[model samples]
Target: MEDEIITDGKYRYIEIGEGKPIIILHGLMGGLSNFQGVTHFFPTKGYQVLVPELPIYDMPMLKTTVKNFAKFLEEFIAHKGLKDVILLGNSLGGHIGLLHTKLFPEKIKALVITGSSGLYESAMGDGYPKRGDYEFIKKKAQDVFYDPKVATKEIVDEVFATVNDRMKLVKTLAIAKSAIRHNMAKDLPNMQTPTCIIWGKQDNVTPPNVAEEFHELLPDSELFWIDKCGHAPMMEHPEQFNQILDAWLVKRGF
Candidate 1:
């Protein structure tokens, strides 16, 4: 079945199936569509999966900030009348999730972060690439995948499309700078929520070392490393990702 789109004035999302709420937040170059691979399966497993298209995805004119996104999530939960939300975030989305958890721990039941940013400073350069630079965008995309072919021209084109506008490029750069400057390592030890930290063993972006740091710091968290996977195990190795997620859920007695 097709997922239904929902909106509460400021945000737009897709709601699927029924039962517990599991919100999936996408990375810097993602939208609700980014979760296509796993969105359908969750509902069948008795979950109300919500994939939101954040403002940063569509409105590049809006300056993206961790604090702002946290506020947005606060309003989003209240608008949906959701409680005990399980947040599954990747990359920038993961950063936002961490910020939200720090600000409003009472709203979350658990957190699942994959190849997440914010635990350590980003290695990406100071500013966004020039608009319409396909080669640059393609190279960056390839860096995230263990297999270069998975980067695909179409994917690169999509990124190019988003960053083609100068205004969007500015916003993207602002967010990138903010990402590198933001650090939540000190706050992790204080987080009381149950957490699962998943990372690609071969991740060049955040690296496995950062994942280990997270596992060490989060008092109530576990880390699962996927070998041979790059920055995006969910996309590069969906089967393994699903298996690990299932096991985590089982352990939680969900």
Candidate 2:
């Protein structure tokens, strides 16, 4: 069965211009609105952008898992009749994109991952302090930003406004914990799709070293580094991010 499309609902998105399809997934604690400016930027550059909010939220009925998240994206593609989709994601969303590519490699035309997670330096013996379970959940939200000022109460409040269930935070933290423990890097080498990995040179959350490892494992992938940015470069440096993305698409003729 193809994916069903629902409109006039809370799940926000815009279909603009018209060319090859490009779907974007947001990181943890983000809604589709996290990409407000992006929809226009891509469409005018000559592509379609589908920015869908993940189905799971505060609803006790909703189950958000890597497996199910991929299923939702599959449905989304089918419902919209999108072909030649260039899938992209950041952080936890990037992990989801990798999983989706593994599941439906043929549906994806290409992949772009930014400061993605799932590679932690646990076994490296870097002598870094290991975060306890409680500490991980309560991990310094401030540290994810290149500038700690971005962690201001207003920004935190805006993010929390979209997070329906506070308990979901526990689940997300645990999911991230498992990614580093279980490892998602194994799926990339088998991937034949054109892949690009973008990183913030100053990213502290995932660290620049994680990008190096991803580049090492995914030998067929392209890596780009952006300076004067942090974890959420898309939001922090929208122009530069969009420019590079546009260039990547141009190379592919999307």
Candidate 3:
């Protein structure tokens, strides 16, 4: 995935297949490779999949807000000359997609969010007192998934590195605060974009109830659940996640 990324001016992304675009938004600590299942599966199924590298840490401290990330997405969409595209996001990425849709509804065709943090604040970047402790960091990473094994050594190392970095750590905390400040509960009902909410039944990060609340708040939303899955349904249960999203897109004629 790293080798496949195309660097065009200020935007760096992965574009595959050729059809209706499905722009993927990676979460705060998530990388483009996290959506390997999506990038590979969707392209073969007649949809162009794109995973943009969000400037989560590159922005100035004051600009490190979810709203600015939404604006950046709009710029990326316009740069690519895309229209009526589907936006699929997870965690912080999901929050950005929601804000983007609310701000720029004309171009989005549909939205898919999993383990998103709009109503309920996530525990990301919390309890970092033991940032220097490898075992502690490893355990924290494992907590994101129902199956602790999903948090591989590489994943743990990546998270450890991010939290240990001074700049990235500060920006991460800033984004977390921005997520809380920009809660979408009051704005969900007014935004009528068709949404597909696929959640893990055992997600401990955002929890299961958040999905139900999203379904209740969003005017046009359908929720699906994957058993034994955690915050990252796509990573933990990619097959189920893809299947549910595929069926929803077909049913809604997207």
For this target, which candidate reaches the highest lDDT against the unseen true structure? 3
> Which prediction has more favorable lDDT, 1 or 3?
3
- The Cα error of candidate 1 at residue 111, in Å, is 0.3
List, residue by residue over 133-187, the lDDT tens digit for candidate 2. Answer: 3232223444556766655565556445433345655565545454565466787
Local accuracy of candidate 3 as per-residue lDDT tens digits, 1-254: 34398999999999999999999998887888887887889888899998999999989999999999999999999999999899999999999999999999999999999999889865664665366788988888898899999898889889999988988989988999899999999999998999999999999889999999999999999999999998899999998889999989989988
What are the models' TM-scores? 0.92, 0.80, 0.97
Badly placed stretches (over 4 Å) of model 3 are 1-3
Poorest stretch of ten by lDDT in candidate 2:
121-130
lDDT of each: 0.81, 0.68, 0.91
Q: Give Cα distance to truth, residue 242, candidate 3, Å.
A: 0.8
CA shift of 71, model 1, Å: 1.0
TM value for model 2: 0.80
Regions of model 1 farther than 4 Å from truth: 1-4, 57-63, 121-123, 126-128
* Cα shift from native, residue 97, model 2 (Å): 0.5
